[model samples]
Target chain A: MGSRIEERFSETKAAGRAALVTFVTAGDPNMEDSLALIKALPEAGADLIEIGMPFTDPMADGPAIQASSLRALEAGQNMIKTLAMVKNFREGDSHTPIILMGYYNPIYIYGSQRFLDDAKAVGVDGLIIVDLPPEEDQELCVPALAMEMNFIRLATPTTNEARLEKVLTNTSGFVYYVSITGITGTAKPDPDAVSRRVALIKAKTDLPIAVGFGVKTPEQAKAIADSGADGVVVGSALISVMQGHMKRDGKAASTMVPAVTDLVRSLAGAIVN
Target chain B: MTKSDLNTFRAGPDEQGRFGIFGGRFVAETLMPLILELEQAYEAAKEDPAFEAELENLQTHYTGRPSPLYFAERLTEHFGGSKIYFKRDELNHTGSHKINNCLGQILLAMRMGKTRIIAETGAGQHGVAVATVAARFGLPCVVYMGATDIERQKPNVFRMKLLGAEIVPVTSGTGTLKDAMNEALRDWVAHVEDTFYIIGTVAGPHPYPAMVRDFQSVIGIETREQMMAAEGRLPDTLVACIGGGSNAMGLFHPFLDDKDIEIIGVEAGGKGVETGEHAASLTGGEPGVLHGNRTYLLQDEDGQIIDAHSISAGLDYPGIGPEHSWLHETGRVSYVSATDSEALAAFQLCTRLEGIIPALEPSHALSHVGKIAPTHGPDHLIVMNMCGRGDKDVFAVAAHLGTDIEG
Candidate 1:
């Protein structure tokens, strides 16, 4: 189980340049489009796909991200629907590792161990619970490890050396280095600042580091890759792209895979070594 | 219970400030420095007699202290079991117990010289309360709310807006109370030095739970004096529905010394506890940390918090206030549940029977009142904290039960 996550990390690293990680709110806009966007991610040059499990209160999100979530909820997104979306993704592909990212409520309501087993059964390789910290990791991290699911920890810029050591202790998957200390979709951090944090984290662990929170453009991705991080996790940027191309014609909204795929292709362009 | 034995009640946290199996500052590092600063500042303020005097002055002058202990003569007859009395917090300046804490926080913020106040709301009651206090203090205010809540709780949102508060509609996640809280936290982080996060409940990190409860203690203090004046005795049972639980704590604290007075907290059981749709923390939770303190929470095996669903927005949280957690563990209070259907039935019953429309949150307690009053015998008196009125809930209730407002 440990080796599997490590291997995924190794594969991303072997590519030498950083891997583009794309995040889409599950059941956002609509479930059908959300699933299509998931399928198109790999072809769009995304090595990792982060699917947001829509929560009632994503405190870490900005207005745009919040609006995207409302649209998803309006379209009727719930735990059952989110799990179904993952199951559908598994039916078509198995190579591109899927990570379920969000706050803890949906997973809590779904039953933690039950959610973990279900994620594993349906091929969800990793989880980035925005709110869960190392001091309280015993609740989910241990159980996730037992189920062979990777519990990724988000190490923020405010994390001190002592706190970072504690946060990284036996943490699985990759160290999710939040580029900034603020919430999601607010603003991008200086690539130099993110690289400094990345260099600091690399000195402590053998685990691959993925930078997230405000890494929107290709330039931002290239900059983070230049800083020695393993991957870039882009959530709100792609969510905005999907919202932009969504037919204003008020007609049947097709799945937004094509536009998101184009955006992913552009993101990959930033990673050309 | 002993004034001299304060150490007995004092549960020391670790080097990191954790209580005995509870009470730690579990916040993001962005807020950690602020939280730590708050800890030190709170310690300093707690020792200041001037701060205490100011809080007392505000309680008496601003909030209309000594909120009534109204005896429900008809309700006692309707139950035909125990005498029923209500702590009329619904009559408070903002029409709820939220102002008790809000006044204190606003004062503290003023003393700290913070320029702005930020708060989060689910049902919008807390937001309204904060807005009112901010208005009184002449401080700029902002409130974050989930989009779903803003629509359902439109009247309160409008009320806040009218009070000159800047409303930020959070469209994130399920766009409920939790999302509102998260957004408020982000806002606090961005503007920590100049802003005060006035948590509405007796939850959150150190000082907040303690501070809010101290401010709300007036409820218990007044209830004690009022009960003594009217009945020359403390009632046998005290009831209040728990949200962030400041209201319940206020009513329950005065009776803590009277061990014979049964303390009960009613939790919102949305559909039913069996269906994963309630906020009945004390009845179904283990000790876990959320918002800022260690308490009873609705979490999965992974310890991630779940979004609680209750017919009453105030009670729809995956966690309970921390003081309730202490009370539950210490066996000082009893915790119970009332489902959405049950609470609604109680809400209608109260309005029809007593010409009073109880908030859905309190209806949960009222529903439990029916169950417990009969078992305690007709002589036993049960005094409940009627935390707020049902005006905010009429639209939601009408839509949910398919009952017309005109009817």
Candidate 2:
């Protein structure tokens, strides 16, 4: 039984377009609105979903996503709530791939083996731990692959050919090629440069390449998808829109879910066109 | 934990940078290559005599090395028990031991051909040190200081500006040392090409914890020699305050092999350890990963990092150096804490008794010294690290004491 992530990529490839990967911090704003947003994602056109487990310190993320994680934590998000969000989403939709993404401290605190067990039980398809490079594979990656779960490693502009070999060693599912050298949501990546880098990584691995980090607009996502990426991941852009609709009292301002889903639909339409 | 031919405490952080499952290069892929490059450059620097000679010359003339290890005659008479000695590192250039590590790192940054230097500072002592070194070396320096720290450490902030270093105030996560570090890491991630991050503490990633410790180890090496010249033997006990454990690690690393010498690291206990408002990571925290390495961190059960509180800004961090975690776990070093009130009392006591105003960072150690000194007999000798001067902390201390000095 192939994982849901691999199946999604294969299906997207069969449809002759790149997959639209969307990310949102679980429990952002609040749990009720968060669950509603997650359930609404698939129909609005996200082929793959990445739920960020809120951490107090998110060194890799830029301001937009950092603020989003802070919002989630302020609303009392934890590892259990993050996993439960996935479980809630799974009850309605089991076909769309769900990946948990964040730093390793929360999971390390949750116990890696136990987190994997609970995550797998709740239908979490993959993981994208930002801090755990290939060097510290024994901590989570190797064990994750052993359980037949996908451990997606991020390849950046700094990841040279020699380092790329190490990065792709135990990596499963797909490769997240960070388009820029900086943190998430900061600088816009040049599509030409990103395409070439993705092609270079593609020469080495059979796994699909999903270009992220500064990918926001439908036009930008379409441009990267047209240039040969198998997937386009949008995060900070979506979170920025969600931030606009959040009330000062920390409640969703009613336009939160619709506004985000509308943006996702446009991005999906651009990718799947 | 005793040093033997077969088992030396010095040989640690094996090839993968693991100090017995404590420290590792827990960073993003973008930082891995840069970390490896730094490790290579440092390895070569260690082997080259030219590097050693240059560092020595700077330490001697620039930083004024061989910092006097003074006998605290009055404190000894007052306590009337053990003979106390203070490793007077506060007399160095920039009025703190922070210059020792900054000089070594600025030289390394030059060797790496990095044009821009960035650092994160808490109380601004490390910021001043980095800024001073950058001025000497003619490199453009940027120091990330938390907004709260900038407000509290206005004098040090001005010192950095005077030294021609740009100070960026970080307002994230309570606007303290941890936030500044997070901001600096984010800056490093963006500008990885020609920028070198000069981490001020014995924390962060692999080479940093080990490298900063080596640079700051001059304190211990000199203390060993100075004690030998003064008393013809090693001291009975060694003590230093820990803020990310750099100054303490500097004094303790060289003595880890001495079976008879007891090493105590004093952490900042805000109100008290039980109040859940302290920065005593070893005493009140558990092992967790933050700022690129695994160490004892003040975190909740759900692993969210808790904000640390302490009277001393330098000691207000939630995490500690990874090497300290290893040393604590191995029972090679004893970790204790001093409360804000205790350290404040020690600050005034040292100033009045010895006529030497020690920084609040070292005051934490001095407070611990007051407790343990009277417990020992006259033959018992104790050495505590006076890592910095209290000039920068005077305003904050005055405010706390309700002196109401008008600016």
Error of 2 at B301 (Å): 0.4
Query: Taking the tens digit of each residue's C-alpha lDDT, what string does model 2 give over B1-407?
Result: 43243266778778888788898988988898999999999999999999999999999999999899999999998888889999999999999989999999999999999999999999999999999999999999999999999999999999999999999999876789998999999999899999999999999988999999999999999999999999999999999999799998899889888878999999999999999999999999999999999999999999999999999999999999999998888888899999999999999999999999899999999999999999999899999999999999999899989998875
Model 1 TM: 0.76
Query: Weakest 10 consecutive residues, lDDT, candidate 1 chain A?
Result: A248-257
Candidate 1 per-residue lDDT, tens place, B48-78, comes to: 8998898788777877877889888777777
lDDT of each: 0.79, 0.93
Candidate 2 regions exceeding 4 Å error are: B1-6
Which digits, one per residue and each the tens of the lDDT, describe model 1 over residues A100-163? 8876645655777888888888778888876666655766778997777888888887777877
**Please, what are the lDDT tens digits per residue for candidate 2 over residues A80-176?**
9999989989998989999999999999999999999999999999999999998899999999999999999999999999999999998999999
Per model, kept true contacts as a fraction are 0.26, 0.80
Candidate DockQ values, in order, are 0.20, 0.87
| Per-residue lDDT value at B124 in model 1 | 88
Error of 1 at B340 (Å): 8.6
